[model samples]
Target: MNPKWLTRAGLCALLAIISLAASAAPAGPPRVAVTDLAYEERVSEYFRVVSASSKSSLRASGRESERDSDDAYSRRSSGSLNARSESNYSSTEGTYSYIDRGEMRKFTADIKGGLIKSGRFELVQGKPFTDTKHTEKLYDIIARIKQGMYPGADYVLFGSINSIEFRQEANPIDHTNTVSHTLSLELVGEFSLINTRNYAIKSSFSAMGTGQDVKLLTSQGGRVVLNRGKVVSEVSRSLGEDVARQVEEQLTGVSSAEERDNSYRPRGESVREEVIIFK
Candidate 1:
């Protein structure tokens, strides 16, 4: 073979190898960042009323006549009766505060870390971006991602705590006269995933969770308050895990191959969870 021909063949072989390698290698995961989570604690009020009433009455009348001579004897009797009823009503009004911005920030951070640990996507960890102004800044978020503010983030995840409600009430424990109560925290959040390159929303979803700390008050005046933050943290972690799975499913059109084997978990008691995907 001519030396020139050998050179051409060598170049062709190198180009072919490069093409094959590029084709065989899997595409890298999208660069993702979690922005600050926002929540506004608005005052909430609730009112309730209960009422009951009862009444009863009885009356009797009788008449008799006797004949023996003209209009001799006659007897008559009559009675009047009256009844009254009384009603009692009880009304209760309560005012309370929801989770504040700082708490929500913590919750968001936990979620960000959880997603990274889920092994579903590559998440870029950085300072969370919070929306202070009332105006929308979703586009601004994408711009920041494009500017490499989040350090090579191609996709951005943003969320807001839509609402938070706290309820405290008493209940009987295990058929005993002893009373128990629970302070419950319910949170609803809206999350969005954006593609920085095209500004396209890859997914938008809503998730809700509730965390309750129970207190049992015995007849002996003994009481115990379960740590509130513990349940809240568990709930936040659960929400984060679910969101990661949702994003993975939406992006790849399938569930993540990696199995989530977290041994310790909560029962998600009284938590209403929902997810809607918009591609």
Candidate 2:
């Protein structure tokens, strides 16, 4: 055979294989836009809750009674005692929030991170939804979709916080003179994935996360420090992951967490609860 003719034949065969492989490749993963979780701007509650086991609240009531904890100029009850001398004890309550409007995205960000980490979908930046608490501006999910809040996204993962709570408890540890302080935070949220084109919901689920910080205190009315930011971050991250996993399972019919090997935990990962001991 002529060398030039043989070389031409070999080139033709290589091109044919390349063309076939290209055609056989699967489509790229679906693109997703995870919106910031929506919530009602909480009515700031000005009130004091005290209990025999809640020394932290007692101290908070005492400090807040003597000083203005919020400089944001919220509506406070007059009986709430417009900040008096340190020696005065005022039994007043006001309405305010423990969280700010700007920080609510931590929950949404967690779920987005989890979905991205799973590599099951491509996540995109999403625009903010209207403040749900303010009725002056009606919430129109369809209009928001039409405005391209999540441009170039095939689906939208919408989430809303249903309930959130924080509490503290203190008790004497057994066989010791020390007191145990435990601070607990819990958050619950509802989620749904909707097809942007037809406005159909593909999947819906709810996820909850809880975190606790425990420390030992001296019996001398010692206080337990509360890190609202730290615990919120921890809970949001775990909550996001849980929501992401649930979304994946629901949409793809994968195995549930209970059906899998739940006992296996990777090394170096932080646990949701931590214990601190003080003698």
| Per-residue alpha-carbon lDDT of candidate 1 for residues 114-214, written as tens digits (9 for 90 to 100) | 66655555778755545455234433566557556676777788777787677778888787868887887777788888877787899988877667777
Candidate 1: what lDDT? 0.68
**Best-performing candidate as measured by lDDT:** 2
Instruction: Return the TM-score for each candidate structure.
Output: 0.60, 0.60
Worst 10 residues of 2 by lDDT: 53-62
Q: Tens-digit lDDT track for model 2 on 135-220?
A: 43323556678987889899988777888899888889898889888888998988889899999989998899888777888867
Clashing pairs in 2: 44-95, 44-96, 45-94, 45-95, 45-96, 46-93, 46-94, 46-95, 47-94
Which residue pairs in model 1 clash with each other?
Answer: 36-129
